[model samples]
Target: MRNFVVSFVIIFLGFTLAIVYHNNNKNNMVKAFAITLSLLKPTDDKSVILINSTIISDFFKKYPDLKKYKSDVSALYKNRNYKSIWYDRKGVIEFASLLYSKANLLNEEGIESNLAYKDKIDGIFGKKSTDKLSPTDTELQLSSLYIFYSKKVFQGIDTKKIRETGWFLPRKNLSYKNLLDSLLINPQLLSKNEKQLFGQYYKLREALKKYRLIEKNGDWNPITTDLLPKEYKLGDSSKTIGQIRQRLAVIGDLKQNSKSNLYDKELMAGVLNYKKRNSMKMDYSINSMLIQRMNTPIEKHIKAIIVNMERCRWIAPEMTKADEYIIINVPSFKLIFKRNSKKELDSDVFVGETMNETVIISSNVTQIVFSPYWNVPNSIIENELIPAISREKNYLEAHNMEWKNGKIRQKPGKKNALGLVKFIFPNADGIYLHDTPSKSLFQSEYRAYSHGCINMSKAKELALLLLKDNPDWPIERIDNAMKGEKETVCILKKKIPIHIVYFTAWANDSGEISFYNDVYERDSRLAELLISDDSK
Candidate 1:
């Protein structure tokens, strides 16, 4: 009986301990599950809320005022898989801060967009607010900001508006969504060196800043000379010479402010550099024209810089992708042949006059015609040739011109208007690059003497360079063809792309900025368009 009682008590104690342990384990598991569920639950705070397509649609519906950017916003969100891009668990990501700062400085980028809801953005960032924002408002506002920035920085004015401004250069079509994707991946792209604008645009912008600083410093004092001579040459001595030295120093043409009252060799060197930059006759003489150019107001220079930056926005970035290409800057009156983005040839070119401005377009040069006939356009025939023929009965024989097929044509000879060669790139404007017989005109300071075509100063050199690699056209054969009386046509194996552009201000490879006269009076028109729209 004693043994049975002891065994029964021990078994009861063991069963009770087992029950207690199982209950404790069950309670602990229930507590752990409750904590995990709390963590997984969506909260109004300390969590990034997703913005799906339906949410975006509802948000736009509530705020119909932002409907204009609905498509762009939707596209952006779709690209991001309907996730919160500008927010995190703490709200408003770091890039939002960077973007807001950049948008506020739009003017520095030559953009004129009035950032909408700028005050709200400033308030959001200024307070570093941790308060939960309505996800709808957050997504919409951030998307709007992205669109505004991309449009201003990546794409300039609308394509139609740019075309209306008479710029026909191929405009780069960019996808804002792609740009945003890049920024989301790497926010440091907001840096000036990594900006979305072209490399040349930034150089011009830097120049703009420098010029504005000069203007703010009251610019240079005007050059006033009591004894204004016909020309001031090297080794001249006068008070005007001192003023010239100071002026050159102010504009950075001279290394130091000599403060001398004599035109020494040092000052002459500065004058030569200045004249070269200004596309003037590079001589040691300082004339009235050069003085006038120097005295041009700093305000005008600033305007020119801003205007050309706008022009840069219209250029396609892919233009430099070609293996070989030609560029004719109309305002500079220069032609550049580039191979692998390196300048192969630079030539002086005479573009059309103001009344007959050269068309801004791109075409491919297909053929080179040596000793070509000039099929005079009807306008020139009726206006010039007929009148000349009436004045001189032997005008046709005297000028090596003849009447053929009821149209006037100049024969292929020394007296031909198109000297010894012509480059043909067929376009609707009836323009081509040709050599001119009146070479004296090229030496003039301003060479806008063409009727609507370009006159090349180094036509023979251009021909040799273009055909140097061709196995068929040797140097001797090219010369013989150019000297031949019959018209000889040689088609190129690879067509060279040519772009005729007009820029009143541009930067060189060394980032030196040059400003030219608005020879066609097109700056004012473009400026008017730019200023008229608050969003540019």
Candidate 2:
């Protein structure tokens, strides 16, 4: 009887162990079938979905611990919206909790999306409720990473160096306040693509520094250009001025002249045009002025070019209105006005001479006075008058000039220095647009005939437009202003901004560069500095 009872217990235990083994094997088979189904994609779809009973069996086998939690990830598969990551919405919440373990790193906006909070298990990781308006940190970092990399790649900022400098050296730590103040409300300066806001990453300190020597001295000399050592490359080309002249000599545009003092008109004009294009004067001579540009350190010029490139990037590509605005190429001594982005007016302008060079400026026009009085500057008296007075006491009266209270003034009339008209705009520099009696001087290719003011070739058209807004203005009225009369002031209803600048060398719209004479003698000074290393 004892043997029979032991056998019965053993048989029952054996049957139970077999059943457990069978069940375990069946569950594993279901999981394997679910995973295998992924390899056999539907003919019409990019991925395969398992709709058999194996999916549920596999779901339990793979995520056996889900029952202990409040949710199951099988729902993602059911919804057919599983992302690339194996983690579903619930898993994302759990993972995020581990990331923001730091307390107070974020505010109320952060808590709703906190993955660590058990209350958000059923809630989707990135699903927005009425309270949340933005993505979670995970999404934000991922999306912004692309933008950050793209910006770094496009701008070519040395990211490795930037990162090594604590990530703030070149971006956040800028002299933004001073630059903002200096710009004085030109919002575009700051509106540029946020990359250069950290006080231009490059430096043009030497180039500007070398060029400014002329600003103080009014001309380039050995002290500024020739004495310094510099090497510059325009754009991507590596040819130097000497190398370029050699190449051009083959074409006869330049003669193979090597003396520092000697330069032909073709070489001279080319250098001048470069200056003009670069916002220097078109002196139309390759003297000291040409040397300045040629000698500026390449690094400094690169910085300046980068800065201007950023500036141009900020400007709107399209015109705002269908109106007229004129751009005077000071170095080239040319003016162009666009109407609806089309060239409506074009003319030549006589810029300031080197001794009394025109200041670079921009302002709106207030009026145009035709046949206006010439208020002789004291410099004229000191330079031209005192010398003339020393020669002939009657010279002042012959020139219609008078002195009162130590001030010299010229009255309007035929042979008056101001000629038929003077276009007026009040500025600190006392510069204006006007016509000159020396119209014959315009025939010369080099036209610098002003004392820090602009002389327009088509001053008559400017007069007509100044009076266009004035309903009462007529030709007779203009003629009266032109007739050897006293000073007349014609106020403009709509003022225009006039920019007097200097640029000597510029590539034309047709891609061919137009060079000018270096009237200011700045090129030679700059070039000397550039070749200072080479010459030495």
Candidate 3:
């Protein structure tokens, strides 16, 4: 009787164990199927039926790095009545995918700063991400992402810091809250929101893509300088010529690399195009300096492209709306005059040297002074004139300068430092565009010789363009005023907007990009600030 009772207990325990194992397997299968179903569904509006408001606060508490956007996230949800914008019952929404892709491409947008909580954000889309985030967590993640992208790409670095980067252009005032609302409604504007950015930003972004590809391919090989001669002219042949040809083809200056050692016509054409784009003297001769410029690492070019893209973000789209405007790119040493969105004139210009950097500011050209007297600034007089006077007692008399009310001023004449014309725009910096007596300076490839003012190579042409339509100032009268007999001022009937900007890299809509020398050495400074706090 005891043996039979033991056998019965053992059989019952084995049967119970089998049932428990079967149930556990069935439960896991059900959980996996539920996750799959959530992903397959088109849209489940009820998933966010009513998220708990405390979840928003809890999420931020857990991810304090994103806390800066907490208010924005909260306000966004409140505007949506706490419904999940980034999701429905079907898991993350389709729009969420687009936002995710854009966030991952911040570098393409010229932003070095990474989104806070990047790993968690990545986990939301990971293969194991399904069923990981509650609806509220996913919602908050995307809201913060939108704000981060909008602020960094559309608005740029913080206001105070951007100002510190020496950019004084009017910044675009974007409302991320309102922008989110529009994006949610249309979704396509997320990609086509050119109205929110300066027109040039898109151009630079395209250049960045090309340069990054070049960098990835490792096409930029520094030429073997010691092996080559000092210069190569037409018909000259060397291994260095082949290297330069390869470089030019890589950058689209040449149609293709003939891989020839001879400096033929094809290579000369490429060299001329390269020189024009690089702000170099347009010549066919390949010199050591030109080869050195060609040898600049592709990485530096990429950085320059990225740096200029940041500059584009700081500009307002409306700044380009004016029918007539003037843009003086300091690094390019060129001034552009546009009327009705067409190029009216393009002229060479010389800006301040490193010691006296020209101020980057925008104002209206309200006045023009013909044969303007040069009222030398106190700084110049103390730093330059006093020493000259000590060397030569009659220096002021010889230079056509005299004391006026205890201040020395150069009299208006052919030899006056300000030449025959000047364009004035009101600003505290006292910087303006004017003519220079030294016409030969503009011929130089690198022309930073002024003292905090722009020396226009075509000042007379610009003055004539500005006064052409005015009946009061005819061609002959304008000509007479520019003869240096006396100073004459013309108040403009319509004020033309002038923006003096600094950009080492500039691009056009036609897919052409030009890299100029960093005259003020501002690119590295701005680049450092861009990546300084990215780890945080």
Candidate 4:
């Protein structure tokens, strides 16, 4: 009887265990079926639906217009495990709304690219409720919108296009996926601390708006004057003087118009300010050339501002992060050495002329050669030297030049074309910054006269500043090296980055706007690329 009871208990317990296992498996199958149904069919709570590659594929297939952004869209979704990035249980997220607004008003950012499917996005927002929302469609549209915004604001023109425009400066590498991740975490990134674009771009954008406003108000009247006087100085009186006062006041150079025909002390101050800003000789006397520049149409200034904004876009924000760097603005004919984000040295420079325009690039200054030899470029030897030698036998001797190793090089002296010292940032173009024999050229307002290299007016000062910390090269030694006939090369302890840029329009930290002459006529070429109607 005891054996029978034990067997009966064991069989009943085994049967109960099998029933519970079967029921658990059945419940799991039912739950899986419900999940598959939710994915296949739209659910009441959109967040419950699983976002997968198939849904994204179907979304793209339905909206073939956004096929151009396939790679960007794919990468964005793949990074998030095919989850809906722009949408949530409530509706489209805050960033979507902000991005849409920014895209619609791209002009405010000085961008010309048209946003794709902008009207469709508007219609989606126009709808009062999320009842008609298609999750897949919404996701794709937002993805496309993000790409459009990135291209215009962050990427600027394509790399190939910028190179074609003659901009060889190091292009900024932008990671839109990372930017999106940050935006997802904090939508306020769009408005604050957008470090992707260079800081100068924002400053130029603000100036652009102000200039556009001036244009909208029928622009200031052009200053018309007779060829009455050779020079207009302080205390001069004429009808033209009154027009100058009005022009200066309109452009914020003068405190008030005063409506007086006399060129008094206040007007003199305004004229000096204007001259300082416009790269003109900082004197009280006004000349016809200065007046002509002042009379440039507001439309042309607006165009210049737009062109420079494009340039600012190409510059990487990271370039400015360096503790020390050198910047040479070609159009401005100015070189600035910055340390710890402040101007350590600023000097007037001579750049290449229109035919031999200086290349826009960035490199590291590794060495400074004092009493440097001027290695005459083959092009120069063929074009100028050979012809000059033919005309005059003593040409080489007079210029202190000699032929060596099948190439012509000027001996290191006061008459050497490369001047007393040269800063070498080895590049393919054979360009460097050096001192010039003709110091008088620095006094001129227009100083674009070089053979693809930069000539610094204060070369000695720059050398001293660069070697200030080095015990091996003191100021006395630097002066002796520059004055000595023997060429001396000194390698820098730390390589300083040098950036050569061409900008016709720029705004200072104080919001003062300055316009420069397009010495190489590159503004129009760049403007054509930026403003052209072709869609990328």
Candidate 5:
């Protein structure tokens, strides 16, 4: 009886302990589950709402058409700790609506394509219907739309295609995740954030609108010269002059069209203005070429503006933020030097000929060589030099060239092909900026005369300005160095950024647009890629 009582008591104690342990374990599990659920839910701060990542994965699976943006969407959500950015306690956020509107009007941004899942996206904001998506579906759809819109408007086309277009300048790398965060805080940035885009983009967009309006309002008739003189100048009278006057007036080159046939002083002023805008010599003469330029249809002009705007999309606004830089527009045959955001110099430049096209690139002007020797490229040697030598044995001696290390190099002198000075910016293509002995070429309206390197008309002036801040070099020394007696090299203490760009259309600060001839026939090719839905 004693042994039985002891065994029963021990069993009872063991059973009580087991029950306590089980209850404690269940309570701990319940507490842990409650904490995890809290983490997955919206916190006291409305902006800190969390979301289940599984929903995002499911969303992409259902909408495979929008899967292109799935990675970007996932990164955006993960950046906010799996938060729902496109939504709040309300069904949809105001910025989401703004983004949807932007996506709808991609045409205004020079984009011609329908967004992915357009019908589903439209249904999100449309009137109530059976096709209305769930709250989660609506949120994911809006996020995908925002990515599409940003890629089209801010980023232009893909990098691979842009590189294929022959634009090698550094492209903009924007973080849309952070961009969205800022937009959510201050939605005004959605419209006023010019910093996010190249400044020229906005200018070109305004020009596009103006040209489209002109096309819509019955474009001006083409000027005909069938029975008129080949050229029209001041005091020249013809029916063609009346047509020219009307043409100039249509594009704001002339304040008003006089409706008179005689070419009067007003018409001469208009002609000069027209010539200036078209990158022609600012003179009172109008010829077949000027008339041909004027004959370009409004549709072509709109396409050119759109093409340039697309090019602008590839550039970043921060590129121009440097303290000093040089912008060489190959089509315009002009070089713009800016320091502290002010135009320091505007000089004439001649780029490469058609067969040897100048490459669009960016680099730093590292050194300036005075009285530099011309190391003729191997292609030129093989093509021209060997043949010239075969024709005349005295060709090399007469040109002050000699075989150095089995390669031909012209001695530094007045007769040197690369005139008195050369600005060296290291590049793989072996191209640089230098003065040319052929000063007469700069006088020509079309200055595509170089082999590949740029020939600056004001090379000496540029050297002086670039070295002005350096105490080691001054105006007197620079002039002495250009006398062509021997080679003198000056490595710049501070390198200046130089960008050789190809822009056939540009808008001035006054919003007046100027058009240049497509020197390399790049506009049409780029335009085709820009407009093609497949390229996008």
Candidate 6:
């Protein structure tokens, strides 16, 4: 970080001096370039400023005509106002030095700001969500963001905040520093790169206002114990406020096991429930985790939300005013179908299990295959099928599936592995919508249990919606496809957009957030890295 910062300052100052010298003279491009080279040559700070004598003569030699590109560089350097500009930059740094009393500064991919805060800058100390971001934070974040972008992700003007559908595969040890270093080395410029870069330097200070790059490393541990009390009790009305504080610290059994003990069972229960709902254990033990959650001043949560808001910005906007669209939240184990701005179908879904936790991916539903054949995944083939086949040769025929390319292929029938139907969505994640035979598995709270395909409980409804635009032909056609001897595909009248996302915390239309368990354990991991010691 120090090396990069030093190099950046030198490069910026070098260009400023060069342009100033040439503006006063007719032809001093080489001299200006040479002066910048000299700045790079010496390690001493005084030596750099010593070149002023050479610059003055060079400037007089070439006058105003050469100064055309001056303002484009640094305003002060361009207008011959270096002293003022230098002082301004110096003052800003000094202000930061005094302000940073003791804050954590970390940069881990898994780190995230506290999820329950919004800072109170000028306003009264209270909770509030603002419209925009911090100009300083945005400016600070851009340097790392662009560096990461140039290296790791493909460059493109995502129409809007978009999801990186499907699981991300790594080429090496996946660490925060490793990723940042990779991005710094890989300089990928997104479309419309020129304007974005040239203008960023001018508004660098202000841009920080638009983003929440700095998050409170407040006290909250998602994985640890952070239970809230469900009830509380009071008996001595004469106790002073200070006395109550001292007594409260020692009172452990909030339930009031005995009549003499002043306790609130209900309050303890409610608090425990809140903790459980937010992914904490239900033990009602306010350990380090609970302490952390309490200290997470509201300002922090707001910032975390804004950073995530950028993810949405990367996606191009879209409208689904027509027929219903299906959204399967991979992390939440739920599927939603909406129409006319209202939810028509919502159901629990069983996704890939622990060992087979589903990968994040997306695609459009082109068609639904009724009474479909199930071509088993290779994992199942090697692990389950081979063992069964070794035990009994007739096992393969009893299931109606045949061997193809060393795979256990189940034929379309009542006993087919795909259950009764399969929804195909062409996606890079190799994921799709389908039905499952293990219906009982849906009852489990932990629903990651597939070979990556989403097992939909309302497969029939989704199928009908897919073909809602089709005239005349309807659900009966789908019934016939099942009865027919050959496996059939019901083509949709039009292609439908299917978004498979992984949002663990999101507000509904009422602006009240409903958080689900992070079954994939992604939330805690992301939160940690995002809140590393690099920036607290």
Which regions of candidate 1 are displaced past 4 Å?
1-23, 26-47, 52-67, 127-133, 192-196
Q: Could you tally the backbone clashes for each prediction?
A: 0, 53, 1, 0, 0, 91
Q: Write the per-residue lDDT of candidate 4 for residues 145-254, one digit (tens) a residue.
A: 89877777777788898988788998888787898888778877775444877888878888988888887887577787767886788777888899998888878899
Q: Cα miss at 376, model 5 (Å)?
A: 1.2
Question: Candidate 4: lDDT over CA atoms?
Answer: 0.82
- The local lDDT score (0 to 100) that residue 378 gets in candidate 5 is 97
The 0-to-1 C-alpha lDDT of every candidate, in the order given, reads 0.79, 0.47, 0.84, 0.82, 0.84, 0.47
**C-alpha displacement of 290 in model 3, angstroms?**
0.6
Please identify model 6 stretches exceeding 4 Å from their true place: 1-324, 404-407, 483-485, 528-536
- Per-model TM against the reference: 0.88, 0.44, 0.87, 0.89, 0.90, 0.49
lDDT of 6 by residue, 194-302 (tens): 2222222112212222223333332222222213342223322212212222222222213232222232444445446445444444564434544455445335444
lDDT of 5 by residue, 269-351 (tens): 88887777767887778888888888988778888888898898888888889999999999999998999999989899999
Candidate 2 C-alpha lDDT tens digits along 1-536: 43565576566556655665778777755555554443332333312222323444444354343232112233322344422121233333232332223222211111111223222221333444333312232332221222222222123233343232111112222232233233333433322323432222112222334334433554322223333225332321222445444433432334454523334455565554455454444455334444544544434433333333222222222222326565676667777766555775666778888778776555567777766777778787788889988999898888888886778877888667777777666677788777777777766667887887787777777677556657778887887878877777777777665545334433334333334455665444433332331122
Q: All predictions: root-mean-square deviation over Cα?
A: 9.0, 19.6, 10.5, 7.8, 8.3, 16.1
TM-score between model 4 and native: 0.89
Q: Largest TM-score belongs to which candidate?
A: 5
- Superior candidate under TM-score, 3 versus 4: 4
Q: What lDDT is obtained when candidate 3 is compared to the true structure?
A: 0.84
Q: Indicate the TM-score of model 6.
A: 0.49
Evaluate model 5: give its TM-score: 0.90
Q: In angstroms, what RMSD does candidate 3 have relative to the true structure?
A: 10.5
Query: Model 5: how far is 61 from its true place, Å?
Result: 1.7
